[model samples]
Target: MKKLLIIGTMPIILDMNADSSSDSEEEEIGETEETTQKPITCLISHDECYVAPQLLNELYVEIFARVPCSEYWKLQFLNKRFSQLLKSSEIFRMRQKLGLVKPYLFLLSSGANRWTMFDKDFESFLKLPKLSSNICFFNGDKEVTSVGTQLIVIGKEVEGITVWRFELEMQKWVKGPAMITPRVMFGSASHGTNAFFAGGVKIDKNSYEVVSIAEKYNAETKTWTAIHAMHKRRKLCSGFFLRGKFYVLGGQNENDEYLTCAESYNEVTDSWELIPNMLKDMPVLFSQAPPRIAVVNDNLYLLETSLNELHVYDVNANAWKKLGVVPVGAHFTRGWGVAFKSVGDELLVIGASSARPQSQSMTVYKCRPDVEEIVWEECKRCCRGVRLNHFILNCCVMLA
Candidate 1:
């Protein structure tokens, strides 16, 4: 007879075949298996505290202290062991990053879609270039005729001379050629490592013009070439990939007047056609909002400045509704505000305080699709240690 034991206590008796091994041999086999049995252990600590129990808790602290809540939540679900370490100082920070908890919004102003962690509210983690304001980024990718990890940002130093680049991973930004003319506030979308930059403001000392010229940047070649220019010029437009096409939405003209119009660019035809205006019959109600747009659950949301009311519009439905609004003084005036979806269908607004351009604030707002009033709150603790450059909310995964 062979017997297996666990915890050096209870034994599991195994009857060896009578025709097989001797009793002594069977006992040896049982002893070997018993020794190899894995013992159940708690994630926190073990007897005598040979190792510091704070290590796991400290890991919990360090990770959340460094990363955002959305990313941290994903890591937590990687294994049961990680989720157990939720009791730590960084939990609140993670919650703040993820929009799980709230109070003071985090804001850092440099440019949208640049990755940098700040140590103070007004100072930035990245060294600003002489023409940092002239640069903007576009997301791109390769494979599947769709966008991937490619990025595009440009600087217009002198003349209407604009330059763009592609990112290799999130760490590097490779430069490309100057555009035919200098442009800013352009819209760019990706189709597999190639990003199309279109519809920006072209500047040439003492005057600026709305432009419709479109250009494409190839990540592999690190080169930018001209594509067809659109018929109309637009500035501060929203560009995104949807249903195999690049959609450009409502933007302002040269006079700073909002235009309730939209257009789509087709790669195959190298043409742009007027699509239905995203906000038809919707009058421009606020000056500060400046046609801010964000996509959530495949539905597009247009935020209005009047009382910070958020209007939800279905591009497919051609319909609209008041989704929610943020409290007054919580957001910056004339700041670039963007929305990011969290791990739990939560929506976060990334913006800088117009009151103070250098200070950035991240507002975590709950989405109430069915309710009349949407609740917006700020995460005080998460932004406590972080000073400037905001929370990397829009550009963390992207290269600046």
Candidate 2:
């Protein structure tokens, strides 16, 4: 009878089928089978396959670190090992160490409770989780900001000021501490570990009133502390952090007049200093709508959504200079829905294209600032056949 055996440090025996025969005949058959079949050994115990798990893990980390952030979600489903490695911070650390981090554009569209992130490396929009239905009941009027990889959304709900934070690492949204005051059309920005909110419209006696209150939320403590108010009441304004100070720019006052004055707040001194108005040297033809601003290489840029134009502020000169119109094909929804974020030397703008309503496309433009001119280049175009009635509510640039 022919027999088989598995050989290793721990051996296993297997019996083979055989007919009745003499002991000598059975031995002969067993010998024949042994001569024809090699001894089975553990493949993992073989010299060539004897790789350490740590070494294999290191190899996995190195290989996966180069993978584009856009494909991470799909790759996580490959296997348990792959999912574990992808979720490990070690892989992201390796990516950062190897300088593989790239900029990604994240968009929050009004009426769409989910976020759409555009991966420039792959020129694709990644699938994101849907926001909680409870969170979706609120209106789209909100202030968006980012600190590190977290995107903060602040909006006034029926209860009070609701704050939600999206963690890019875990790919989920969590409720943040509620604001002390319920306000809308607020000027907000993220600075270091805290998010600052400035003047905004508050409801008083069923009427809207612009207030001059200022506060900052400490993310670590999950608390909001009142800070010195801005020098002027600002509503429908925008705020940005630069040079260790928070700057509020271009908003309407209680008089419902567009503000030309700008101010910077010093956290250390608890004071505000008036800065040169963005409209100081601009032509009267510029729209009164507050322009979207972004900071690139410590320089400030303003995007006039109506004209699809760009302007740069000279800190030393205290003047704003027009950098001409953005790329010709760029489109905005109702002279709004445009967002600007600085990634390295490029300013990334995201908005809808001028296609028909039923076939509107979401487009991203990369603006390269030069000494003579600002060159706009198309980065990615998606949602080709999908109609997007909702405006681009908020957008921020993230690195991964």
Candidate 3:
């Protein structure tokens, strides 16, 4: 076998001949010794990438595979082959590791309340039909809970417990366990492998009274136990885990004065503390306002219902500033349905519940980093008619 190595436009040919007989042999010998050479032209924008053709493919897979996307895309324009590989499955695998695929959103439902769950780009919502009862969402991770495939509804008696579970592969809902507490207007938050339920009226109608009891349920152990009591009773209050603390905010007291107080439960010490009244310095824009909060980065954002104002509290600075207001006519329209969910780098402001005599609809707006002119748009197309209150984002199964 003969080998020829070509670099640039320069081509080298190998020739061999053996001297033999007469004039005819001399002609054959001259033809065999004749060699052709051509100069090869090549262009390169970057000097580092130059390589021989045989090793080019291997070089690319090794180089761009590890290069940051900003640098990899620049290489993509070099040739059609590189561009195709950039859009190929291998590159998407790189993106998956980078957390770039459509992120996770889990929709959770209870008999009376609904919430959306997500982290990164994924989002999901729980579906609720009209006039249904007996519902709860469960998960083991308190930091990022899942709307368990399980569903529970309480009938007229404590024994009347109905359970349902959704199988993703089969795409159907099957039966599960019965809830220990048959009540509505309760708040549920998960920590570790257990979910805690607190503060809901049993809704006995004529016997209607707010319930102050707290209970914790283990999804793994499948058991329930009553926990420490809350300092002040709260119903329809927002529940969230922030900075290793459980924050319960803005629920009605026995008199239902639209309490503007906030309380925190520490998991480390198993204690509850009343946070100082901070929003009072700001005017009471709406006496009926339901305050909501969202944590972006490490900062806490308080969405005051009264003024449609966005007050941000910096965790590092321990300071508060009113950045901007939600669009007009945003709140109280969907009563208990309003919530904030994080989508990528921004917060998704979802409007739910009916504050007025209006149809049940949901709107989601993107809260921008810019203090002025934050974007608020209707997220109905994405959320459907499902409403979310205290929507929390979590990272679970990544669905591309």
Candidate 4:
């Protein structure tokens, strides 16, 4: 039989034509030839000298963890192993453990049931699954929060309280447990496996009544438990969980007046304590829209809707310090419809700005938090020449 050794693009042929009468004679001849013959040398090209080492399953998982969530589905076509590995929760667990998980911005446009996601790493937009039914939209009063790896949307429909949970791995939405009360324009925050809902206005008759009711939903148990209500009725407020407590700040009261007071709820004691006002002299107004809040590090950031100013609440100092005004286009109206979320170390603000005489443009600003000077830089510009009035309904960040 002929023997061939492929060292590069070139193939080397070896002669193995020697014959022997017996096994002993053949063994002796082979030994003599191997000892006396000079080894053939071949020069291999740089591209064909060595092949890259195949990645181990564990290494592949680590690499996949850094990939943006929007691109995960497209990677399945590479091979079956990738499809299986991408589906496994182990990769995401590794991502979370290694701190490789990045926050993905999910935007829900008004007057449309479909959702669009913005991936900061890739700087691209992706359309997510549409709402299964029209009941998912709640006249721009829906509240959204993230619990673990799932995105939960809470709102009221004609039928009753509607809740939907979007499983990140499955990339689909499923019916979640209904709320005990059908509320709108409420404040919500999530910690661990539970989500806390705070004060909001509910329709009593023809007029709207501000309610101080509060509740927490357990994602694991799929049940709701009533928590201690806030001291004052609040609607269009911002709620967030920080340092083992839920804080609700800055909203309109029963008289439809803007509020500057803030409060925190301690679940361990089942009580709400009044905290210092976010602004000492000025009131936080949300007449045009709800205030936006994001938690970065241990500080809570509040974006005033009317003034377009950024304020940070220091947990240790127990004081609010003015950051800086976000740089929206001059033609924009008082930051009324801007959406805010914290992605990694940067704060992302998205909204519509005047592009031309009659058209609106979508703009995204990335703001860095600093005590001396917090600066806002334009990161993305989209939806040009399109009317984005009331189009951006809600925005939230999901770590993936």
Highest TM-score scorer:
4
Could you tell which candidate, 3 or 4, scores higher by TM-score?
4
Question: Which ranking of candidates, highest TM-score first?
Answer: 4, 2, 1, 3
Winner by lDDT between candidate 4 and candidate 1: 4
Q: On a 0 to 1 TM-score scale, where does candidate 2 land against the true structure?
A: 0.69
lDDT of 1 by residue, 38-61 (tens): 211122323222223354344334
Residue 325, candidate 1: C-alpha displacement in angstroms: 1.7
lDDT of 3 at 306: 59
Per-residue lDDT of model 2, residues 1-400, tens digit only: 3333322232222223311222321211112333333222222333222334455456457656776665565555444555665545666677878998777777776556577776654246765687663543355466777654567777755555677877665577788666777677878777645778899988645777799899888654567899998888988888887878899987888887778888888989988888756555543332344457888778898876656678888888788778887642233343456667787787876665433334445566676785665667765444443334335777777666
TM-score of 4: 0.70
Model 4 residue 97 lDDT score: 89
**Reference-based TM-score of each model:** 0.54, 0.69, 0.52, 0.70
Displacement of residue 85 (Cα, Å) in model 1 is 36
lDDT of each: 0.48, 0.65, 0.46, 0.66
Clashing pairs in 2: none
Which digits, one per residue and each the tens of the lDDT, describe model 4 over residues 1-400?
A: 4344333343433334422222221111112233323222212212222222232345456656766666567656555556666556666778888987766777776565567766664256666787775643546467788765678887766555578887665577888677666577788888756789998877644656888899998765667899888898999878887778898877788988787778889999999998766645544333456657887777678775555677887766767677777554322444455777777778877775423324444577776685466767765444332334433677777766
